[model samples]
Target: MALLETRDLTKEFGGLRALDRVNIAVERGELVSLIGPNGSGKSTLINTITGMLEPTAGDITYAGTDLVGMKPFEIAQLGVGRSFQTASIFPELTVSENVEVAAFAAEHDSFSVNFFRRRDAYDEVRERTDHILETIELDAKAEETAEALPYGDKRRLEVAIGLATGPDLMFMDEPTAGMSPGETEMTVSLIRELLEDWGMTIFLVEHDMDVIFDVSDRIFTLHEGQVIARGPPEEIRDDPAVREAYLGGEEA
Candidate 1:
């Protein structure tokens, strides 16, 4: 069954149509990659689906619920999560504390009770935070400051923060953006583990064809704000239009 579906999705910024009548679907437990050159609407489609940008026309449905008018937080609460292209976290906070804070805020969004709430009140969040740290292989660094970790570990911490949300489906924008080859390999393995071990579906926006081709079950190609091609990895690798547009006429 389709875990997420978008029908005739369109988004406009004034006179610019960033996404033009695009339709895509992700089945549960599949790792789907969305690839396109810059300005081809990859990020625009992710933003629209994740509620950062409202679509001008069309429908977005997740787990059978329409997400057309939902807020980002609401979508997150509904088991959708995202990690930005850049690593986002508090440098001053400890690694465990970073996930703990996100977990606590996710559980209680209201700020009115902050003054009376006790640290002991967040027992559940604390437990989950530890589990997330372990899952992301950062448990050994739990007491270290976020900024003190190596660059690759910091990236993993950001993934930990997203995992703390307990999402069934995740949108990752360039998860291996600035990693070294070894780090990239580790991250790739981590993403695969999310599918095999955690039973999560992923919709990834990435520039690295090696990473995309290595991990994605299916690939979607976007060009000039429209979905140009989509199919299995081998089919996408052999697509002529994909070569002319994004691949620069080179074979994958």
Candidate 2:
């Protein structure tokens, strides 16, 4: 079975249908990219799948469980994690502390103050936090405040926070947005490494065609809140609808 599957999923904002009976399936260990023009519902699909927005109709099946009505925390607990277009991290906290906060939330049974009464009692959470920092190559800056890191590192720290949730599947919304060419390249490399070395599945939404084509196992092109096409990168690049609508008929 597909690792994640959606069947005729629909989400409406008043009379506007943000998602129109969208159906998608992601296999385990696949790096799938979502692309489209603005307002094409790429982010809407991600938000709906991740429980940030409730679907108006249809089924979301992940690992054989229906996810349509689940809460955001419930989805995270089911081994799904998400990183936003804007980096989300604690600016005042040290890099390590940022990841530690996510780790504590993911590992603990409750959010009560009593959970923090004994730091030593949560050795596993601490170890996982450190491991996530190392995995994302932020160990050297573990003690630095999040706001002090460069922009690229700040983005990476957001990924680390997502990693702290121990997800098998991760949704990254425009991870390379507003980055320099060099920074974008490095982030692309890091994403490839995450898939290859960390054995995680990724569903990515990115405007950078180079990064998406270079890294995606398959690409889904959306138009007006529905998938217009889905295929390998080569096929997608040549698809008439995709080329005309989003790629602007430019040769890749």
Candidate 3:
């Protein structure tokens, strides 16, 4: 079975349909990219699958378990993790503390009294946080406040936070947005490491054509809330429908 599957999934905001009978499947260990122009329902798909927005119809399954009706935290506990298009981090908290909090949530499922304990109290959480920080190359700035870091580092910190959740499948929503060329390169490398070195499956929503073409094992193109094309990178690059819908008949 695929690691994540959605069938006839639909989401409606009143009369406006953001997603329409969308169906997609992600296999284990595959880096799949979802691409399209703005308002193509890319983020809506991610949000619905991750349980931030309940689906209006159809079914969602992760690891063969029904995901519909589950809360976001419940889904995360089932080994699904995500990073937002915008950096989601605690600006006032130190970098290490941000990851540690995610790790702690993964372990305990709820922020109870255990959250008040000393940071070092949980050996496993501390170890996992340290490992993620090192993996994302943020260990050197572990003690710095999250808001004090550069924009690139802030984005990396979001990735580290997601990693601390110990996910088998991760949803990365434009992890490289608003980054300089050098920063984009660094984030791309980190993504490669997550898939190749850590052996994790990723479902990515990205706009950087270069990054999508370079990293994706398969690409799905959406337009007007429906998938218009899906194929390997080379095929997606040359797909006529994709060019019309995503690039306005211009070459991709």
Candidate 4:
């Protein structure tokens, strides 16, 4: 069975539909990309799948079970982790501390309430945090405040925090947004390492064609709130329909 699947999922804002009859299936250990122009409902679909936005129609399934009516954290507790387009790290906290918070969540402990309890027992969280930092190549900035780190590093910290959730499926809204050429290349490499070496399944939405083509095992294109085409990189590249929607002229 597919690890994550959505069937005819939709969310409507008044009469305007954000998503309409979208069906997507992500296999375990696959890096799938959702690609489309702005207002194509990529973010809206992500929010609906994560339960942050209520769907007006349809259902989502993870691990062969229905995900309808589940709360956001409830979905997380069920092993779905996600990062938003905006960096979601704690600006005031150090990078290590930011990941530690997510580690506590994975272990089902309260970082907020247990902030001061068992200070000596935090070696595990610290170690795990360090591992994630190293994997993302942010170990040198572990002590730096999240707000002080570079934008790309901040996004890496966001990914680290998402990893700390210990999820079977992760959704990254845009892993390469606002990055320099070098940083974008580095971020793509990091994603490949994380999925190929560390064994995390990722469903990420991105506008960067390079990142999408480099990372995605499968690509799904959205237009007017529906999936218009989906296939491997080669097929998608050759698909005239996809090109029409993505690169074709709409101007008169």
Residues 1-252, candidate 2: write the lDDT tens digits.
999999999999999998999989999999999999988899999999999999999999999999988898899999999874334687999999998888888767444566668767478777888887777788999999999999988998888888988899999999998889988887898888889988999999999998998999999998878888999999999999997776563333
Best lDDT goes to which candidate? 3
lDDT of 2 at 45: 97
Residues 153-231 of candidate 3 have per-residue lDDT tens digits of: 9988988988888999999999889999999999889999999999999999888999999999999998878989999
- For model 1, the stretches where C-alpha displacement exceeds 4 angstroms are 85-87, 110-121, 247-252
The window of 10 residues in a row where model 2 has the poorest summed lDDT is 243-252
TM-score of candidate 1 against the unseen true structure: 0.91
- Identify the runs in model 2 with alpha carbons over 4 angstroms from their true place: 85-87, 109-121, 247-252
Q: How well is each residue in 134-191 modelled by candidate 1, as lDDT tens digits?
A: 7778999999998899989988888888888788999998888889999899899889
Which residue pairs clash within candidate 2? none
Q: Output the worst ten-in-a-row residue range by lDDT, candidate 1.
A: 109-118
Separate clash counts for every candidate: 0, 0, 0, 0
Evaluate model 4: give its lDDT: 0.85
Alpha carbon lDDT of each predicted model: 0.87, 0.88, 0.90, 0.85
User: By the TM-score metric, which is better: model 1 or model 3?
Assistant: 3
